[model samples]
Target: MYTLKKSLGQHFLTDESICRRIVASLEAYPSRQLLEVGPGGGALTKYLLELRDIDFKAVEVDDDKVQYLKKTYPAIESRLIHQSFLDMAPPFEGPFTVVGNFPYNISTEIVFRIIEWRAQVQSTVGMFQKEVAQRLAATHGNKVYGVTSVLTQTYFDVEYLFDVPQGAFNPPPKVMSGVLRMTPRAAPLDVASERKLFVLVKTAFNQRRKTLRNAVKSLFSEEELQDDLFNRRAEQLSVAEFATLTFRMR
Candidate 1:
């Protein structure tokens, strides 16, 4: 038996219903290659392996959990990658769908890494802190709508699928968890470059309360900043609006 590691944010999902729901969400996006990030206790991993004709891999950071998973499900021994999902290379060369009940501590950073691999990540379905999930699926004018919302939506369509209560886990998390399904956009947003869009959005939201002119003044010239759009706060702009504004950045 593996002891849960608080340092790893290990709140293993104990609810079979929640586990099936997550797997169902992943099945909605068809991909032969699948990568499960932080498959803590094989709650989802067992179900994922049952799918036919799919090449599956799971990344687990904890050696104890990895050993436990291998002992419990010998089939996963060869499939599991014993490393941090953050530092691992793409599990598949071509497109793949990612799934997991992400560790709360590094959940947002995981999303960022997924965005970095956007080109090959066909879709993703994972659980996150409800607030973080809302922010990813949030739209302009909502208080939770900010950099994550803008940057992620720039490449994928984020869907807030369902909520999982805190009690669904063995050692229940203090906060509620929600599942999100992200599918790549049919076409990428027209931006100067992903880098510029990232720079512009991160800069604008760094001072979210300030008007774009005040918040991102360093990215654009005083002349360009005079546009009426600059008068609005960062949260007022849609992902497309942010992508468009990237063209005007210095």
Candidate 2:
């Protein structure tokens, strides 16, 4: 009944099989708490509501979709959080799994929020613009590889699950969508400092075409830049290699 608003990136999923497949992937990990982001049209929310074992909640930004979900699925009356996933405080007291057909407009921001909550979020299964998904699952040497690949891979093991065609939604997106699953690493990466690593990664990629020595020259000294790792470009360094560069920073 609600009109799809292009500004909000509201392309509601009408496909049943893909919805179930995504929910199944969310349940693949054992979670006592689960949260769904942007449950537009209740495509995935209905199935998640049926699960009896976990505490399930969904964050929805649109008022119409929120009212519709509460009216259609009375089971979610208390489970729904009427706020943007970006603005909401942590929904659960402890660890939880996050799933959804996330808004393409803010999909990348959603990933950054998950990273911010990396300690409490056990895993995540969400759909993203295919190019973004490729970058998330990408490794060094891949053209799409950049900030997301390194930042996300720092805390979670990225997995590209599958791709969904444009036809899968009511107002299908112009670009194809891909789904990915991210599980937290059992141990945090052994970086000298997480903040330093973040700066290092972002700075190096700010001038991606330049060699690391030139790209991140401001962050290091001439003596420190003598390492061979500085000879490579930003896209050529792996996650571990980036951490090592962080420790070497002056």
Q: Give stretches of model 1 more than 4 Å off.
A: none
What TM-score does each of the candidates earn? 0.97, 0.97
lDDT against the true structure, each candidate: 0.92, 0.90
Give the 10-residue window scoring lowest on summed lDDT in candidate 2: 185-194
Q: How many clashes (backbone N, Cα, C below 3 Å) per candidate?
A: 0, 0
lDDT of 1: 0.92
lDDT of 1 by residue, 63-112 (tens): 99999999999999899999999999998999999999999999999999
Clashing pairs for predicted structure model 2, backbone only: none
Q: Point out the worst 10-residue segment of candidate 1 by lDDT.
A: 21-30
Which parts of model 2 have CA positions greater than 4 angstroms off?
none
Clash pairs (backbone) in predicted model 1: none
Cα-based lDDT at residue 93, candidate 2: 96
The TM-score measured for candidate 1 stands at 0.97
